[model samples]
Target chain A: MILSEREEEWMTAYQNGDEDALERIYTLLKQPIYSFIFRCTRDEQLSIDIVQDTFVKLQRYKHHYNPKHGKLKSYLFQTAYRLMITKLNRRKKWRSLLPFLAPLQQSEELPHSDRMTIREAVARLPDIQRAVVLLFYYHDMPQEEIAQILGIPIGTVKSRLHAAIKKLKKELEGGYNESGSL
Target chain B: MSQDPFKQDRHLRTKLDEYHVDVPDFPMKPSRWIRFINLLASPAKDPLDPLISTPSGLILLKIAPIIGTAVVTLIQILMFL
Candidate 1:
């Protein structure tokens, strides 16, 4: 996750109070961070919020960023992932306390989503496993970098990816498509 | 569809590709800007907010008028003396 030269320059410029450099970094990093978060959370608003917070955090902690520490994009992904997990955890706690909110939360689903689609199957994965799958298959991230982002050991990341893939294989055995039934 | 793990991975990725997510562009300043505006648009604080905003402060506020009247009457009695 070492920074490329261009990212290093951006970080240096950002640390020098260059607002436009921060914007440039955001322009480069936003899509990847947003994609990872949206695919992980499956909530557009939540993803946007996390992406926005990630940039804000980057700006707030600009002085702490060193190219020697990691890649800029990985740092962004880690921030978004942690923010998402925290918010989602808080939400689950609230939902448990107020079960009436379950219906409201479920209202995000489509009305016609009866048959299990591939996306649904992925969504049904546990949060930990879903993160692994999305990071690996969707984002094409390697195990070591994912380990860095998830703050887990490389072995743990592999096991999670294996567990996720096994669960996905089981859920998607029937070859579900976006159109519902094959 | 395929028994090979690599092929299965590829197949899974392709299936996931079907779940297209489009990330929209948003300006960086709007969040901070909205927050500043919200702060500005919030209700004005009472001049005595510091005096009455807490329990002790509220008690002090409630007793101030009686204390002022007592002090004024005491000053009048002293003037008579």
Candidate 2:
């Protein structure tokens, strides 16, 4: 079941020590939270670890959450983003030596031909544009919400979205006639 | 011999949107009491933690003011005596 508005309320209550609310919110948003983290990290073990740690951090510092700031999901995403940055930094040393952290055709499921091409095209964009694309299309976020999440201007979101779409179209279409399916 | 690249591809967007993969979960099952005890026993490593250091450093931080007050009070009492 989708996370209901009541469930979001209950999550805050759970953070405030309502035990029953804890179980309810866990069942409600756990999968989506896991999926979001997984997409961010692109590592299953790390994503699960981060999700668990995010909830732990949430519970441990419930007082730090300012209701005036935004919705519970927004707070959660911000927290996860911070944690993901930390994880990436920590993994940097190891990643440099390995040089294989990002590889072609490495997505968990061997993506179909079209999907693989799209992921490759996405991987080529600059980091900010890549993040904008992921947050916009992957998360199904609105332009204003994407701005809030990325701390970029709404105009920037529009421009990046436009540029990204154009770039992706160029790359994808370059492969279209070759694939003989489009 | 070429398609209009500026023409937006709604199908591509929809296909990308539908891209879903099974992500494995790394679930943590630490009990609350154990987690709490671990929290209390281990010095917090978070940058914001007040006691993010050796026990002596934390003790020195917490009791320094009280110790200063006590020492001054003791000196005053001794002088009066």
Candidate 3:
């Protein structure tokens, strides 16, 4: 799709070191960006913090951005994922120390809700699987694109996606069996 | 292996898309501390900052590596002697 003139202008001005332009782009993209990060981390607060840190990184490394390689949206998502991984790693360290920090509260379980159940099940997945699942289902990205974005091999993406799907299948079936209808 | 995993389970794909998560907009202002930092580390945009652009300055920049190596070697040699 053709970018609106405003988006193009924002990108042009942003590339030229305009802080206002950066803020404008951040306002425009932050929801979808937060959605992408929230799907990965599943912690609303942590995702917000990571999204903020991602934009700061974008501002600091603004000079390194190349408009030719890809769309600004893709670059923003990639940077956010990298920052999210760093934050998750730090959280892992803190978990080792405290050991009693409550697990992130999960989404409310709904009655006979296949999708919500699957989504909740996916959230309970290990980090890499959760990332792969969300990037696949939520972003609607193909396996190859996901591999490129996450810097993993296509084979790894395929395997993780396969495993994730299997896990979701099990969760859906179990939920369905209890409810006696899908 | 199947063309559509969703085909086997029927409602799977459609249902997968249903669980909408609320993605709140992150509130952030480039705070004063951040502004001060950006100002401090901000690159000299002046196309003519000598430390960055001039030939003599460039040579000094290049010489920095050689000088660093020589100093390290001298210190090591003096320690041995």
Q: Highest lDDT: which candidate?
A: 1
The TM-score of chain B in candidate 3 is: 0.40
List model 2 lDDT by residue over A55-78, tens digit each.
Answer: 888778877876566666666766
Better of 2 and 3 by lDDT: 3
Q: What are the lDDT scores of the predictions, listed in order?
A: 0.73, 0.64, 0.70
Where is the poorest 10-residue window by lDDT in model 3 chain B? B39-48
In candidate 2, which residue pairs get closer than 3 Å at backbone N, Cα or C atoms, i.e. clash?
none
For model 1, the superposed segments whose C-alpha errors exceed 4 Å read A1-4, A98-103, A106-115, A176-182, B1-9, B30-81
* Residue B67, model 1: Cα distance from true site in angstroms: 49
Every model: Cα RMSD to truth: 11.5, 15.4, 17.4
lDDT of 1 by residue, B36-74 (tens): 564355333245768777999999999999999999999
In model 2 chain A, the worst 10-residue window by lDDT is: A99-108
Give the per-residue lDDT digits (tens) of candidate 2, residues B34-70. 5455435532224424564678778877798899999
DockQ: which candidate is best?
A: 1
Better of 1 and 2 by TM-score: 1
